[model samples]
Target chain A: MLQFSFWDILSNLLIATQWTIVLSLIAFVCGGVVGLILLFMRVSGVTPLEWFTKGYIEFFQGTPLLMQLFLFFFGIALFGVEVSPWMAATLALTFWTSAFLTEIWRGCVDSIPKGQWEASSSLALTYIEQMRYVILPQASRIAVAPTVGFSVQVVKGTALASIIGFVELTKAGTMLNNATFRPFLVYSLVALIYFCLCYPLSWGAKKLEGRLNVAR
Target chain B: MTYKLQFAELLPYWDVLLQGLIFTIILTLVSTAAGIAVGTAGASLRTFGPKWAGAIVTTYVELIRNTPFIVQLFFIFFGLPAAGVMLSETTAAFLAMTINLGAYSTEIIRAGIQAVPKGHVDAGVSLAMTKWEVLRHIILNQAFRKIYPALSSQIIIVMLGSAVVSQISAQDLTYAANFVASRNFRNFEVYLLAALAYLLLAMLTRSLLRGLGRVIFKAK
Candidate 1:
């Protein structure tokens, strides 16, 4: 028989928390790249690209991420691609993050006055140059608060990775609970860690939103 | 390797799938209605109630918003029993989802309430209406209309999120997918079917909520 103490459990959970942070970063950074592409296509005034991105966003947004996780985790296996929980979790979360981020950023870009585009194009700027020099810098400022706010969702989203057997914070809590038979103590700490990670971003978003409103 | 989907195998489990879908619907409907009520009250409290009430509700909203729904569900289902509060999986799902929607909706509705022109409430008060009357007829009526799109989106989000209840065997649609996949090892087919169902459910829920909104708020 083996005995574990409180410090042992907390330390182990802390180590697993690192994976949660890493996974969230993976989703956030990769999702940002993909979301920007989608946003550009959406607002680029090209009909087919706009419709394609529009449908893509709806497909991802209109369903559960849990289902998408299961679909990819098992669907890839059908293609004989045995995915580790790490790969599956990252893939599902990245796509989910991209969908929401795309919508958020599209709104920001669209918020830029029509004159910004007209003024840039009147100078004979290419599409890319116009966006780079004129629109995106302005839009990114508006995107900052909401983008940070959405990162909290990605962090919380990583908790679902536990269901697929990813050794993240939530899974560590469940494992510790089984070992210690103290669900109340274990999960309270789990929730606390998430709160600590998330509350700051949410509060910051609120403060930034207020400031942005005042600027107008 | 030739891999083929066997939808035939899942055809036998339609009963289970239908049952789970109905349960998911019930869970969503019950929670959505109650959650909006809770959110409405919380928004009011945070906006107009005493300082203490506002503080309590602010804490509740932050707690729910900042954490994952599955963690909250697990905490209620597994953690509460240790403190002498045991809830069935269905009840736990309902409570967790209602709280989740409540927090999000509180923010949405609060935004709506804030957008109400101050003069509207002032006018209602000057008409000899009590505070409650002004809150209901003047403020809330307009606030709900203003926030209908946002509030409905949050509700559908919670409904899609309810899929996680299956992890605890609450017999939602995902649970049926799990059961069918495990039994037949047609994990791809089963989950694809479930995802399609969820997509349909989401579309149906969105339109249904929009219809309900029109009836309630007279949103054009």
Candidate 2:
């Protein structure tokens, strides 16, 4: 029997942690793009688009991420699609992140006064011009801190991918625990790794929020 | 071969799903009650207690907030046994959910408490009210009222997050979905039903919390 040393576990976990980071980055970037589109649909001043976006956000927000992951993983099989855990996790998390991002951004955009819109319209700016040149610049400024804050959630959300067998940090910990029969050390380290990954983002968000508040 | 979604195949397992749903609800209710109590105490301490105690609570809040709830559940369920603090799956899930919600609610309630004006506390003191009385009557009531919506949202989030407790075989709704799916091989349909059940539960829980808020805070 080959005895696994502590370094064996730690090194393996560190390698698995990279996958978590990569998944989080992909989800956050893709989700941000989709969320921006949803945000536009929400605030597009078209009733049908606004309603559709509202329903989309409500569905994703009201359900658990675990359920969403299961749906993507198993739901794809209904069409005989061979969905990999990585792809399913990414798809579920992207939609999940997008719903939240759109909601967060809608709040930021709404905080911009009606006067800004009217002012832009008065300047003969089309909707796209008004959004691109005037509104987004200001809204994105307010959006920065919370957006960074939400990235913590995206990072944490990647942990659910492990349930789908994505072999991320949490899954790697489970595998190591099974091998080592040391659930205590394994899970504590797992939680610690997640903390290391998330705390700096939380701190950065807090600091940015403070700076934004002071500037306001 | 094309697959058809046979949601009706889950009919025989409806009772299993319902039991799991009830367990999740029970878990949520008990955890919410205990969690809010812990959070209130935590927020109060962080706001008014001694510096060292506040520091401990801050560390706890940050630790729990920064980590995933599933890992916390795993630690309590699997890890604690190695250290001689053995807990059943349900007990561990309860503990983890309470701890997770407590950390979040502490932060939320602390914001509400900090938002309460200094003049309010001073006025209570000037009236010769005891410290306990001041906290109970003047500060907490207003703080709860102010943060009711946020508190409601957090509770719902916790309820949704509780779905993961099934991974430990805690018999949550997701567990029923997994069990039924495994038996029937209708993974998609079973999970679809489970997801819809969760969505309904969330909507119902939100309105229920809102109504309870109205009744509790209707006085002033």
Candidate 3:
């Protein structure tokens, strides 16, 4: 059996952490785009689109992300297209994150008071212009802290990708544990790394929230 | 390239799926009960206890909140034996779920506790109510009433996240899905049905909790 040093395990885990970061970034960015579209559909004043968006958010929110991943991984492959774990994880996480983001953004948009909507409309502004110039700008301000807070969830959510065999931080930790037979050390380090990745975001969200409250 | 969706193939495995669903519900019930207890105790201690006790709880809450649920489950299930703490798969799953919810609800409950107006506490004090009396009758009731919706949502979220327990080979619904999928070679159908089962379970749990909330706080 090959002898593995401490540095070997640490360095390998560090290397894999980059993929976690990359996946989280991609999911966050893509999810944000999808969420924006869903938000528009949800608030568009068109009943069918609004109903569709509501159902989309509810389905994604209600199901576990693991099942969503499994569905994409196997469902897509069943259609004669091979689906990698990476692709499946990305698709699932993106859709899951969008559901949450749209819901959060909707709450922010809804908080702008009906009077703001009425005032914007009474200015003879079109719906698009009202949203562009009046509603979204104000909602975005309140949306900042919660949005950052949710990114922590997105980062944590990527840990599930490891179960599907995406060799991210958690997967790398498990593989290393098999090699080194040090489950305690490997998993604790894996968790610590996640904590480091997530805590700053959580802290920043708190600070922004505090500042926002003070400003109000 | 041509694949027909055959959910009918899963009918033979209905009993196995039902067993798994029951186990998932049991896990949710146990964790939700214990987790809320842990949260209430932790919140009370953090808000009213000595400085060091509050700091200790704050650290625990932060550690658990920032880590992933699967990693925490892996740590308790796989890693703890190395440190001389052996836990069965079910026990570890339960512990992980409870601890995860405990951390989240401590924050939520703490917020609720803090939101209790100071004037109410002052009035309770002036009324000659003991500290415990005040906490029980005056403070906690209002806090629970205010934070009931958030606490219910957290419980549901933990229930959904419990699907990860199957990764540790716990006999949850997801594990049953994986078991049948591997045997039947119907991975997509198995998982889709399992997802639908979960969605139904979530809806059921939500309504159940909503009813419970109405009963508990009905006087208010």
State the lDDT of candidate 3 residue by residue for B29-79, as single tens digits: 999999999999899999999999999999999999999999999999999
Better of 2 and 3 by DockQ: 3
| Each candidate structure's count of clashing pairs | 0, 0, 0
Worst 10 residues of 3 chain B by lDDT: B211-220
Q: Give the alpha carbon lDDT tens digit for every residue of A1-216 in model 1.
A: 667787888888889999999999999999999998888898889999999998888888988899989887987787888799999999999999999999999999989999999999999999999889899999998999999999999999999999999999999999999999999989998999999989999999989988998997
What's the CA RMSD for each of the models? 1.4, 1.0, 1.0
Candidate 3 ranges with C-alpha deviation above 4 Å:
none
lDDT of all the models against the reference? Answer: 0.92, 0.95, 0.95
The positional error of residue A3 in candidate 3, measured at the CA in angstroms, is 1.9
Give the runs in model 2 whose Cα sits over 4 Å from its true position.
Answer: none
TM-score for each predicted model, relative to the true structure = 0.97, 0.99, 0.98
lDDT tens readout by residue for model 2, A138-214: 99999999999999999999999999999999999999999999999999999999999999999999999999999
Assess each model's interface with DockQ, reporting 2 decimals per model. Answer: 0.83, 0.83, 0.88
True contacts kept of each: 0.86, 0.91, 0.92
Candidate 2 docking: what grade?
A: high
Q: Per-residue CA lDDT of candidate 2, range B20-98, in tens? A: 9999999999999999999999999999999999999999999999998889999999899999998988999999999
